[model samples]
Target: MTIILKEVLESEKPILRNLYSLYLHELSNFTMNLNLGEDGAFHYEELDDFWRVDGLSPYFITLNEKTIGFILLLERPFLKKSNDYGINDFFILNQYKGKGLAVQAARKIFEEKPGQYFIIQVVENKRAVAFWKKVYTGLNIETNERQDLIDKELCLIQTFKV
Candidate 1:
């Protein structure tokens, strides 16, 4: 299947909401092995803030014209220690797991928009911890921790230098 990553548009708001709802439901049910709760779901207020942020961009991941996941990138501050871009959110349908679609999508993004560093924060739960470890190793990435957040115990902050 051909996987495509494109910028989210205003006309696709409904589809975005539906996809996000599916993700939120999965997270809420603890089906995806993530630690996020209902509070993690995107809300209208968050959407408004995202729209107003010039440094943040939302991307939709599609396979054969069907949207399967999304990724949000938040650019770094000009004076940041690392000129890395953050992967704010990356989610794929449960049915599509283990297909390496996420790796493909991420590779595409990195190729299209190259950066020196790429960061991803994964919840420190069983499944996610394992998944992120494998991803980091398979992709030859280096992992680290960010101590700024109070919830660091529940989160694994990883960074990759490309």
Candidate 2:
């Protein structure tokens, strides 16, 4: 299973939008704020900002040439912090979970874009917290972790350099 991280293009925004809808639906299980719009679609107002914003990136995670997930990368000036980058959003289709694909994709991104980084996981999302813990351990990277409230949800924030 060769994994590829392809930068999303303007013409392919719709594809990402569709995938994001599914991602949001899945996330609704862990958070209460997500809802379908009047158009019956999950709206992500900032989806287009990836193209317009200087430091935002949208990458489609493809395996064997099929898109299975996506990663939203936030960098430098885009974020109001000294950290080099942040993983704004990451999702793999439910069908693709539990096969170590997420970890490999994450590792690939971190390896390619080496710098100070931070990751946040809602405290209620045990799987995501464990996933990040596993990634940190597997890579043997030291991490600084703390609990914080974000959007009224308690979240575990991990900071480290890659």
Candidate 3:
């Protein structure tokens, strides 16, 4: 399977919105405490914000021409000390889990968005931690782990340089 990261554009908002809805829904139900109400999910308002920001990028993850997931990379001034770039959001459909596809997608992000990067995962989300751990270790990348509160919830923040 060929995994690719395509820069999401304004005309592709429909596709991004659909994926974002699913991503937020799954995360809310499985990992985070956020509630998803009837056919609607959070993150609708932030759709355009990414395009407006200079440091934020939205990429669509595709495998063999099929859209499966997305990665949101942001450049923050500071996090856990020095890293400027962050993996703000990453999600693969339930059908696409356990195949190391995400690792490849992440590796692509590491390549395309080169710099001292960080990915923050909720501490309660063991799957996320494991996934990020695999991506970091499989790529032979060095990581510095830290703990920080995001939205009043503690999160495991992993920082690395690529």
lDDT of 1 by residue, 60-128 (tens): 999988889988777755226675577766778888778888878877777776666545444534565
Give me the overall lDDT of model 2: 0.91
| Best by the TM-score measure | 2
Predictions in order: lDDT: 0.67, 0.91, 0.83
Per-residue error (Å), model 1, residue 155: 1.1
Model 1: weakest 10-residue lDDT segment is 147-156
Over 4 Å off, model 1: 29-44, 76-81, 118-122, 146-153
Residue 119 error, candidate 1, Å: 3.5
Q: Per-residue lDDT for 48-145 in model 2, tens only?
A: 88899888989999999999999999996788877999998999998999998999999999988999999999898898999899999999989999
Candidate whose lDDT is highest: 2
lDDT of 3 by residue, 1-162 (tens): 779998899899999998988887767744555666575565656788878767678899999989899988887632345777888999899899888899889888888778888788888788888988988789999999999988877899887899
> Could you tally the backbone clashes for each prediction?
0, 0, 0
Error of 3 at 115 (Å): 1.1
- What TM-score does each of the candidates earn? 0.75, 0.96, 0.89
